[model samples]
Target: MKQPNPERTPILLGQIDTDNHIATTVSLFVILLVVHRIGISVYRLYFHPLRKFPGPRYLAATELPYLYRNHLKGDWVRDMVGLHRKYGPVVRIAPNRLALDGSIGWPQVFAHRGANQDEYAKVRGFLFPGDHEAIIAAPRDVHRRQRRQLAHAFSDGALIEHEPLICHYVSLLVQQLAKRAENNELIDIVKWLNFTTFDIIGDLTFGESFHSLDNSEYHPWVLTIFETIKGSAMGRFFAAYPIVRPLVVLSMGADRIKKLQEHQIFSKEKARARMAAGAEPGRRDFMTYMLRDTRSGEKGLTTNEIEMNSPILITAGSETTATALSGFFFYLVQTPSAYDYLTKEIRSAFRNEDEINLRSTSSLQYLQGCIEETLRCYPPSAETPPRVSPGGEIDGRYVSSGTILSVYQWSTFRNPQNFRDPDSFRPERWLPTSHPLHDVRFDNDNRSAFKPFSAGTRDCIGKKLAYSEMRLIISRILFRFDYEIAESQDDWHTSQLVFVIWDKGPLKIKLKPRTMTE
Candidate 1:
């Protein structure tokens, strides 16, 4: 071998030095990253503002545990029930978040603000795209404006005008169930309820029906709506972990994403078409009321605002009513005493099916009680949208600014402190003490805690409409047919996964036409 050259030796030494520098940099970088994480965790555990609150230390140290359990696992509603039981009314669920039971928490956190107080801002991360424009996700001032404009459509006077249209669809529902009853078929009551409610809301919002009830099957768009709602949980998860969103999107597949986009497009197009058609005189559809304000040159929603809000109105009006009714029947048929009592109440109250209108149905005390209990047990909007604190007290505990809190509806309604025999379905629990049906055991139950539609200025505006729909539909169905649970679907209600809204499967039942004795 030739003698080593001076230049070659220098180059080899230089290469070794460069490798050593790269290794040292990477080692230092990794060490810093680990140290940073540890420092943050320690801060969260020992020095965070929420450190005094009771909760799993891991959850308080990192949001990962809460996000993993609630969002990824789709078990937040069920999990909250256990969490509140273990940690009491106030629990630190994340480093910056607390879950409040609805009793004192609902009033303190969600009640109307005082003169000097600012509204607790909504947690933006919980919303889906386009939701910011809708009343549900609008900023405080924006929400007030939107609510004012939209309030007329849901007014008592407006609902009176819409009654005939509502009755028409309900009649169609009864007729459809009659056919299924004649066949002795196992009817998926959930699907039928969905069809009825979707058609009603579609007609009210679009000035056209989805024809789901007429077709005796779901419209493609209606099917897509359910898919979109289920996918919202995953969307919320991605929103929380934006760094992982790109990877999650890739795994979600293009078809699913495309379907969601198509649903949005469909809603936008329908809204546009409704706008172009112009309002029909004496027509009381939702658009007609919105157009009235716009045409009168009042501070009403813009054309774009109308389009943005149509999907919100449709989903809010339809899915929630359908869910409540589904839960109503699920609990009703299983509780034979409740079933018999309600059926008697309905039959005795109405001599002819035609007489069972919204007005007549409202007077059925037991029916009303049953509906109330159903709402308590299985609220349509089962989870509360998280609200950000503005550095105030909640349930007598001080919450720092930017802290996230929510009165989890599932936990509140099911809490033993709020109700007697909380897990059991007892309509009497909702009756007043003076009522013959009222149970003494539930006398001390925290009745104020039973806010299924929520409370305060931001409460659900469509509450009156929802109650009317549920009462009319359930009373009519029970009056027309005698039904039984087709299969042992005891877990049908509880087995669902909450994705903002419930991801409910089929509720199967068999119906027999009740003989009319004039």
Candidate 2:
């Protein structure tokens, strides 16, 4: 009887043991994740591959320093240049990223053209309906195909054809600013710059206006887009790590995502609508120009491609021009000499508001120099543009595949090798001659090193339009007004995005109408 009881009763205990083992294993994994992240932090501080590459320890270990500087308006690029001066050009800016502030890394860095936002299946960039192409986020071949499809539009003839559209918007900007001056009201010059650029880009890309200029209140879409970008200084940190993104997406809901979806729908539908409307007797915009290119099987762009390309064009079209103008205005006001100089040039050139045409405004050399200096001093995107290596060596050292390297314009322009008084706003240095303080030879080397437009096969397609818009708007504004900063706000330095800068809050300045005559 005792033997029988022993055999029958014992088996149940084994099942409990197995379940405990599973529980123990799960506990160990959770503990490992905590340990692994800690190890990563510690190793970065000590044994990381790029440890010898100098930088502030916090930035090298993680993205926190970089993100914090952007939020704080402490100017990371400028800080980076300072660091490079202390450390060296080849500094580790983040755990997996390197900042090559000097000339060692160009051909090996940006020449490769790595994958863009579209390549990140886990994340998405702003999209529209007519195009699925990702100019800023795709493989080399994809960019080539897309750029080729749109290249003809940027020709001299095309730019000439696009002049009237440029002229019209500049006129609108001048009109609105003049009206404000007439009323003797203070306005945020930065906000108006936002309004002007977005509306013009909206009209050209989707054949619709964001109406920001007309409303004087930001369109919801414009606000959303700008907010997304505005948050990019921090957002890019979360974006790059990806470990914390799902938590964020879960927290923010799909509202902004849904709005982006709507933009794509709007882009595609507008393209279709524009095509259907056909040629009219009045005038042509970018839509009709693009329509003439495709004309065959669907002949225009497919909805997916339009969805991809439209928002990009709008982004490229709006971002740089707005930033340059904001920087232009800020510097002009900050350095009254430059402002007075520009004003004199504009006043001398134009007899009235009507005389500020696209052609008429571009004649002033000092104004152009100021615009260039503004871009150099305060570029929209100040960070190193992360690009892949071309399966080669940088400065004769071997580089592995998939290495994400970069050249930041802010840091590059500030480098002693590139400019004299690198931090100074000397527009005269941009002239054709060499400067005594700095060498200006970085403008056009065989490689795209100092590129705010990026370089090589993947340079920004909106460069021509961006220049036209910035020049036209700035010229007209200077031609029309004498502005002094509002008493309440005294600071002008603004925040930066991943590759763009958001200067939206306010540059409240009182406008005194210029006589339009010298």
- For every model shown, the clashing-pair count is 0, 24
lDDT tens digits, residues 1-518, model 1?
88999879989999999999999999999999999999999999999999999999998989987776666567877888898999899999999999889997668877888768888878773745867677887888788888888898899998898999999999999999999899999999999999999999998887789999999999988887887775666677777788997776687654555667778899899888888877663566888766665435774777777887898899999999999999999998879999988898899888898999989998888898999989888888888788888998876778999998878788899999899889888999877777788888888999888888777788889999999999999989989899888667989977887876778989999999999862
- The lDDT values for all models are 0.85, 0.64
The candidate that wins on lDDT is: 1
Candidate 2 structure quality by residue, lDDT tens digits, 333-401:
887767777777777776776776666656667777777788777777665446654345556555545
lDDT of 2 at 16: 82
So what's the TM-score on candidate 2? 0.79
**TM-score, cand. 1 vs. native:** 0.94
Q: How accurate is candidate 1 locally (lDDT)?
A: 0.85
